[model samples]
Target: MHAPGIWGIIVVAIVVILLFGRGKIAGLMGEVASGIKSFQKGMRDEENKPAAQIDASTTVEPVAQPEKKDA
Candidate 1:
């Protein structure tokens, strides 16, 4: 089927606005915008950081075990 033209899109938009008040639509749009912004920020942060950066203090050394006596 062919895609809806400008008039069809406009009619759909009007119907949606009528069903859900302007305030609710505006709030949803705001939330969507914020989510997109947050995603972009996370992507940028991931790009800047190193793949692996372990601290020396956090590393654990293996402990020595005592030998068992024969029966």
Candidate 2:
């Protein structure tokens, strides 16, 4: 009663797909998969990089040094 069953969800999905047509849905899924693969590849390449390289790339220096105040 509280939760909708799986069959009801599947029926709704089928109706939406029928309205949108299969080709459009397939193309969208292909793009999504390509994006995910590229993201994963980037992550793996980062992981495989040397620690020194990562540290150097992410280093930030202070833009302005404060003057010492007179005692």
lDDT of 1 by residue, 1-71 (tens): 99999999999999999999899999999999999999999999999998996878888889988999999
- Give all candidates' CA lDDT scores: 0.96, 0.91
For residues 1-71, what per-residue lDDT tens digits would candidate 2 score against the true structure?
58879999999999989998999999999999999999999999999997764556677887997999999
Window of ten residues with lowest summed lDDT in model 1: 52-61
Superposed by TM-score, candidate 2 places the C-alpha of residue 61 at a distance from the truth, in angstroms, of: 12
> What lDDT is obtained when candidate 1 is compared to the true structure?
0.96
Model 1, position 30: C-alpha lDDT score: 100
Top model number, lDDT: 1
Residue 64, candidate 1: Cα error in Å is 27
Off by over 4 Å in 2: 52-71
